[model samples]
Target: MSETIRRHPEAATLMSYAAGTLCEPLAAVVTAHLSMCEDCRHEVEDLELIGAGLLGSLAPAVGPAIRIPKRPLECEALTDAPVVERRRPDHLPAPIAQVYGLGFDTIPWKRLGPGVWHHRLELSAGVEGDLRLLKIGPGREMPDHGHGGSELTLVLDGAYADETGEYRRGDLQDADEDVEHRPVADKIVGCVCLIASERPARFKSIVGKLLQPWTGM
Candidate 1:
């Protein structure tokens, strides 16, 4: 199949993901993108194979005995958690669903502006980063911002465009401190995206700057 994704994560980023060295949230975003992108999926698979080959080349080392911990009886029943069937339009990619546990409608969205809403996701303890779902109304303009570190955004539905280019469903936009721009949703349908940020965004506009502290972006 032809490559559907226009923007892709860099080789170094993909390699870090394959090596399991990326932060949890960033890895989750890349995994979500990989689920919708065939070309990137194939590339990740190749990297995994290469990683396995390198591991096989290492000499076996004798390590200290590891003790297997027993799980408490109370935790046994907790494994049977309820799962909701995801609906259309807001159906999430597998990676995201695995981490989020709930569908789109179930997300608790906080109104960020007239046409923008966001749902901040809580990662497991010790995981560092900001991960969230952003839903923007049609013709809405996202806050103009620059990055403190790196940011990864994966479009789950509809489309949006920024100074770099247009991003549609299944597209991943990779931005870093070097990138700066405001993204606007398509006039007809708006957009919904999964975003993972290494650090808080630095807003450019006066209004955005005023709201940045409270928004945590």
Candidate 2:
């Protein structure tokens, strides 16, 4: 039996993901969350099966369907070297590690603030939403903020707590416009999370707002 996951994506969100309609970055975070949560993974599989059944019932188009040519895989811009076999860190998910040549320890992190660092991941140009990895030092609090649309966070390591609850490794947090809370990293080992936001965070403090553009939050 799959272990019960404390946190899970909403049924609608899982349906959207299974339907392949979610934005690229958001989809990536959902994919990572599925990797760690067997319950959610089963939910997703069920949703996919339902979707497949529904699609099979749709009427076929009378006219010839348009076909788009496929492009070659080109991820060289994401790293210094071309794709090659490299063992990924046990802490990092395969969905995330495959994008970059470097392991988690070697990722080129950009300092965002005191005890905070981030590394942006590149999706295709014009893709909606944004994906990034955030590492917060022990006892540090993330900016007090509200979401513009929806935000998805998956804990890859350690833990953090907010108004909702405490989230440990493999936990997934889904926040929409109605939610607003500041998360504090666990005081002992801190936390590392994968984040997908539809829009930049709306920080409450003036200082945070001033730093938003620079930090690309």
Candidate 3:
């Protein structure tokens, strides 16, 4: 899956994620993408190690010593412990599956517009940003729009293409305020994607703008 992915989040974005500085919404999208792309996972791991090394160089804060509690030793042997098996839907990414807590077929999609359906994901209280799953009908073209801040989109199923390039399953699109284009879904399979945006998208058309308030894109 990693070998086939042609797009990924920018190095800066991954670095921010590794440094624990990325916002929750964007971090969720990155997490979903990492589940599919091993190359990106390695990159993030390397970044995290580097960050850990830097933090280790800092002096420890002076404070009163605190005692730590120790766990009691288990009486049972390791081989006697029961093994548990857990399974998740094959079609959905691990992070998404855990958050959604439902199968893809059972998702309650809401109509956003013609040929477009969306399911918004709830964030923790006071968290700023938008995160959602979008299902676009075959050959449907999205409205031309630019980002207000940053937007990270991960392709979960099917494919879509825009001025930048075509994105297939496991591909991630990292768009910022400077990017402006329209994406069209594949004619046959359509497309289903997980999108996280730092701010609302800026639609170029009046119809798109009118629908924006309701759609909350």
Candidate 4:
């Protein structure tokens, strides 16, 4: 790997996730990574062990026997092979192979330009403005635009920047309508991001509508 984007090691995020301390978008990044990185999976298990140890030392407390659920396929799919690979939906980071593989490719990702493209993913059908993936491609830049809804992005393989700053893997960029951005990805290797948008793009024009279909806005 060229190492264009600096990945904040899974250790930090895993620990936070195990402790239930990370925010939603950030946790999603960690969960997305854990789907690929065995090291992080072990780290989360270690944290669970530590927690169990702590619980063992504590006095027994009364609580409901709630059935904690497991993510769809861990033991069979992810844990078996153990090596992360780039994804086809714009060759996402090795960690996000599951995310791309699960259902991203099935959706129609429309191109905005030579290098720019995106697709609107269904997070919750009932929710009017639900979280959706705004997939960006290598080295392309979005126009100077603002969000009418909230936007949360986790950098998977590459990185992007705006008037705010740069976002790398495991780096979460939370943007509100107040945020106006024109992000440019690295030209050579390009980048892929898992962007959950609360609102649609504010650039309402012929070109904007073309971009809108990809976002389902």
Q: Could you give candidate 1's per-residue lDDT for residues 11-78 as a string of tens digits?
A: 88888887778776777788777767788777877777777778885433221111111122233353
lDDT agreement with native, every candidate: 0.77, 0.76, 0.80, 0.55
* Model 1: worst 10 consecutive residues (lDDT sum): 62-71
Residue 185 displacement in candidate 4 (angstroms)? 0.8
lDDT of 2: 0.76
Residues 178-215 of candidate 4 have per-residue lDDT tens digits of: 87778888766666666655446687456766665664
How well is each residue in 66-167 modelled by candidate 2, as lDDT tens digits? Answer: 111111335445555654443536567665665544466767888998999999887676666778899999999988899888899988778999999999
Off by over 4 Å in 1: 1-3, 57-86
Q: Report the lDDT tens digits of candidate 3 across residue range 122-209.
A: 8776778899999999999889999999999898889999999999998999999999989999999999998999889999999889
Candidate 3 colliding pairs = none
Error of 4 at 35 (Å): 7.2
Alpha-carbon RMSD, each predicted model? 6.1, 5.8, 8.7, 7.5
Clashes of 4: 2
